[model samples]
Target: MHLNEKVIVITGGGQGLGRAMALFLAEKGATPVLIDMNSQALEETVRLCHEKGVQARAYIANIADEAAVEEVFGNIVRDLGAIHGLINNAGITRDAMFIKAKDGEVSKRMSLEQWQQVINVNLTGVFLCGREAATKMIEGGNEGVIINISSISRAGNMGQSNYSAAKAGVVALTTTWGKELARYGIRTGAIAPGFIATEMVMSMKPEALDKMAASIPAKRLGEPSEIASAVAFILENDYFTGRVIEVDGGLRL
Candidate 1:
């Protein structure tokens, strides 16, 4: 994938790592198609991409909604002609311990709502968007790429049963899609990021942030640009498929 003048769709392109990826790819001559629920943020991202001297468009859609996703992809192809790549970067975390006990007396447990919300947005959303993107790519007869954003916590982290399960499922989907979609010139890959300095993470207290940084072997939070670079690598490398590139600063849970 040369990226030049290619149409790349990025979910959650309103901010953070998604915004970084859109800008980075825009610099490489790719026209970014941003999907997010935040219309204002999406507008800002599109403006930034345009400032980079590339055409960009934004769509407001709830990716977890099947009909909405299908319609969004249909609109993209209708408006843009074809999709060359998709980055399944939209996700949410509803963190809670599976069981919380004090002195052997159970006080709290992860709620079904919490679990379902994460699974719906993170796991199912990825599946829906990936399916639609692949369908569009095939129909247009374009070779494309799909990249799912996983996390180090996919290995199972405390107070994150829902998130961990969803992310783990994302990796499984990546592997499965890589195998099934290869015959169609569509590649699939995943990236598991460590602690990154997104706006939400950077808002933590200084001491808390310091503690997190000290735990990673790299001794610092990752930059959003670093993750964007990994996304670019997976897009440009023809042989990289069905494998996850961990950008975790040597940290494991």
Candidate 2:
């Protein structure tokens, strides 16, 4: 879609892929309504978008909170008119082995907190934001798109049971929503990225990061802009729906 003057809502738009997508979309002339729990980070993203000549706005809201999401989307529509798209990118990772067996003595298991927190934000948050965005799109009587950010870990990455499960759920929701929302002219799609060179991934040790890069057939971590470009393709290609665009560098679990 030509994003000129279009209003797109992006969750977790403070930094990393979310921030990169926001800036790229803004450069395409879309008015990005950025949402994140980090007020300072959100504001910084907005400033960067503004500097790029887009009227971007930031809202501090927890996507997992239904009430907060509703209120924030409401304010977004009030401030920016109709919502054209939503990027469900807000997520967190609390990686842990499902069961740590040390010398056959059952050691540590993934905590309830770890599992619940990941599910709450990664899965539930996507559902909440997609639902709200679809509602507003249908109510406004406009065709729209929803781009969900899944991960290559959805294929069952080691030490990421919680994250993997949640991302798999995201993929399921993407196709389900695509089939269900097509009648309403709202297309849904997902992007599964592998080892992107974001801040979080860069924090790993050099050896570990090098190992990760070597594992990918592309011989490097994917760039945030590449993922953003995939999102744009999904939006512009009206015939695309109910499918996942894997942006992984030919990596298989």
Candidate 3:
């Protein structure tokens, strides 16, 4: 699980938490396969990694597209050799209420498409990537790690029914996959992050961000590097799997 010289796949590696994780892994001498749907952002991440003298590369593909994912992964293996680790980090949030519940209340107004999109990327994508990665790892006899980027919202956010459901599913998948993949010598784990200082959160209204910070016992925004630190911990420890490490400054939601 040492990062040095390991081949790792990081979905949504173009920006946000994914980019930070990729950079940190590369800094530790891991060759990261940066996968994302945004070609431009992917390129930018590669350039940044190169500046840091890390061996990093980018693959442009939509994780929601099965064929695209398979094709891109095939090319990565052909080009980068066997993958030793996978970080299922691609995710999207479509904030909406089940119905027009007053102030993020629960009802049944959420459109089918909204829920489906989040599920496709957050939950199903974990299964797809984990299955594919484990298949290769077993075939290559690689005993490695699989990390899924879950979120505190998995506990149930006020207006994040779809996101919460999908993230919760990811945690379930992490536990399930860990046990199932153990026979193959692969470990699966997840990270549930609290409010971090990603661009998405920074863009929120100042007062809203302040409120979130105040709610956290830490009284501050968690850094992306803190989550990266958690990922490193997960990968480095062999016996820690089929469980989630909540890295949210002690915040439950």
Candidate 4:
């Protein structure tokens, strides 16, 4: 779990929590292999890490594509050697109320497309990446860790049926995988971050944002680095596995 000399693979390592975690890990002497669909964003992160004198590189691929993810992981192993960790941070949101009836228009149906998209990346993508990483780690007969980037919304978000379902599934996988992989000395855990002021959440209405933040005991949104710090803690704590750590500013949703 030590960052030193560790090779970690991160999904959605472009411009949010994943990027922040990758940067922090690199600074700690871990070689982070960042993967994202945004080439320019990934490049920007890689550039910053390099400027900071950290070991890092990037790969651009759609995490939802199983074949592409497998290929990217393979190439990462070839380029970075054995991976000591995997971070499943790639995710997307498609929000729709389970039932909406504002002005009688009554629009609340969650679309098949929305549900499928979120599941493909947030849930299935994590499974694919973690499976590949575990296979490699087991094949090499080494110890490692797998971190799933879950969210507080996993419990259930009012308008984010798809996101909620997908993230909820992620937490389940974290616990199940941790137990299933214990024999191999590979640990698995999850971090559920709340209302972080990333580009995604900051784009919401200021008043809505305030309401969300005020709901939390911290009375402010979390920073991406804060979540990164939690990841670091989990990585270094050898006994922390099969548990979902909440980094949501005391917010319980």
lDDT of each: 0.97, 0.94, 0.88, 0.89
Instruction: Write candidate 4's Cα lDDT for 78-158 as tens digits.
Output: 887788899999998888877767888876687799889899999989988999999989887779999999999998878
C-alpha lDDT (0 to 100) for residue 164 of candidate 1: 96
Off by over 4 Å in 4: 101-108
Question: Tell me, what's the RMSD of every candidate?
Answer: 0.7, 0.9, 2.3, 1.7
Model 1, 1-253: lDDT tens digits are 8999999999999999999999999999999999999999999999999999999999999999999999999999999999999999999988889999999999999999999999999999999999999999999999999999999999999999999999999999999999999999999999999999999899999999999999999999999999999999999999999999999999999
lDDT (C-alpha) at residue 190 in model 4: 95
TM-scores, all candidates, are 0.99, 0.98, 0.95, 0.95
| Candidate rank order under TM-score | 1, 2, 3, 4
Q: What is the TM-score (0 to 1) of candidate 1?
A: 0.99
Q: Between which residue pairs do clashes occur in model 4?
A: none
lDDT tens per residue, model 2, 1-253: 7799999899999999999999999889999889998999998999999999989999999999999999999999998889999999999999999999878999899999999999999999999999999999999999999999999999998999999999999999999999999999999999999889999889999999999999999999999999999998998898999999999999998
- Candidate that beats the other on TM-score, 1 or 3, i.e. the better one: 1
Rank order (by lDDT, best first): 1, 2, 4, 3
Total clashing pairs in model 3: 4
Model with the higher TM-score, candidate 2 or 3? 2
State the RMSD for candidate 4.
Answer: 1.7
Estimate, for each residue in 1-253, the C-alpha lDDT of model 3 and write its tens digit.
Answer: 7788898899999999999998888888888789988999899888888887878879888888788878887888888778899999999988887766566765568888998999999988888888888878887788989999999999998889999999988999999998898998999899999989998889999999999999999999999999988988899899899999998888885
Error of 1 at 90 (Å): 0.5
